[model samples]
Target: MLDSIKEVLITQEALQERVAELGKQISADYKGEEVVLVCVLKGAVMFFADLARSIEGDVTLDFISCSSYGNSTQSSGVVRIMKDLDKPVEGKHVIVVEDIVDTGNTLHYLLENLKSRNAKSVRLVALLNKPDRRTVEVHVDYQGFVVPDYFVVGYGLDYAEQYRNLPYIGILKEEVYQSK
Candidate 1:
């Protein structure tokens, strides 16, 4: 699996350190409020688990699966909700957790949908952000890293659903995606 990677973009240690710090910030920010952590499914599965464990305050968790990239590098430009949150967010401080923000379409759609449901306050927490590729502006309250617009995989990110198990984030070789 290591042989397929062109280079390691972020080490496992670095990811853990950043996540821990994010947890601290979140704990402090929502210290006296009712907090609901919404995990965007699949890609954020790993991040949500780690973040949830690290947070110190009272927090409730829910998950919703959303998709824009259906087995492709770029989004289809239309976001769809494959699964919806089990609980309502009305008058609750909500934090939307995501693995990565690329084009920002999914986040924008999610933000609007959450607002329509009357959430008290909505904030974004993304593990990775590729600002160069953004087509829509997104406000990320807690961003792990600002990355270059390279196709990256691992730490819950994937390519062809094959690289999510990798411990570190790495740049996928071009040939892997271009092969006939």
Candidate 2:
């Protein structure tokens, strides 16, 4: 799998340091408030776990799975909710944790859906942001890094379910997917 990587964009140490900083910022922002951290499943699992631990306040976790890409690098532009929150988010402060925001289609749909559910407030925290690819407007309250247009995988990001276990985020070689 290492052979298929073109370059490591973010080191493991960098990810850790940034996550810690984000945690501190979040803690301060929501001080004296209990927030629900909603993890956008599959891709943001590792980040969600690490971030939850770094937070220093009352926090509950929930998992939501949405799919726009299935074994493809590009999104089909159709968002599907594979899994919904186990508990109602009504009257709660909800934070959506995502691995990356590219086209913004999925997050836009999700934010609207969550808001309609009567959540007191719904905010977004994206580990990586790629504004160049956005097709819709989505506000990210907290962002860890701004990445260029590259097929990145690792630290919970994946390409066809591979490379999620990599310790750092890396650019996947084009040939690796082209050959598929």
Candidate 3:
């Protein structure tokens, strides 16, 4: 599948380093407090696993999967909750962990949903952010990389559910998705 990639945007080493750094910062910010990491599933799983190991203090992980895209390169602007968190986040310092924030629709919907649950606080931590595609204003408290408007895959990001197994993040060639 490397043949489908036009360029490598972030290497595996870089991604690991950044994630570790983010973990350190988050550990400092929430020191001595109970943290519930609500991981946005499927895509963010890889980052979530590594980050959880790096964190200090009391940390718990929950997963919620919301989808805005199917097999397309762009979001549909519609957010659907495929799976919800098993545990309630009420009265806890909750962090929404996402693989990428593109168009901001899904994340905004998720944040509002989580807030309505009576969580003491909610913040965002995204591995990648695409500001150019944002349709709504969303605050990302912590971020790994601000990527340009390119179709990226690998390291938990995917194209039609493929390329996610790749270790590094790379820009997918337009022709691959265009042919669909």
Q: lDDT tens digits, residues 19-48, model 2?
A: 999999999999999999999999999999
Estimated TM-score for each candidate: 0.97, 0.99, 0.98
Error of 3 at 46 (Å): 0.6
lDDT-superior candidate, 2 or 3:
2
For model 3, the stretches where C-alpha displacement exceeds 4 angstroms are none
List pairs with backbone clashes in candidate 1: none
Residues 27-120, model 1: lDDT tens digits: 9998977789999988888889899888888899999999999888889999999999999999999999999999999999998899899999
Model 1 C-alpha RMSD vs. true structure (Å) is 1.0
Q: How accurate locally is residue 64 in candidate 3, as Cα lDDT from 0 to 100?
A: 96
**lDDT by residue for model 3 over 1-180, one digit each (tens)?**
889999999999999999999999999999999999999989999989988999999999999999989888878989999999999999999999899998999999999999999999999999999999999889999999999999999999999999988889999999999999
Candidate 1 ranges beyond 4 A from true positions: none
> For candidate 2, which ten residues in a row score worst on lDDT?
67-76
- Model 2, position 42, has a per-residue lDDT of 97
Q: What's the lDDT for residue 19 in model 1? A: 95
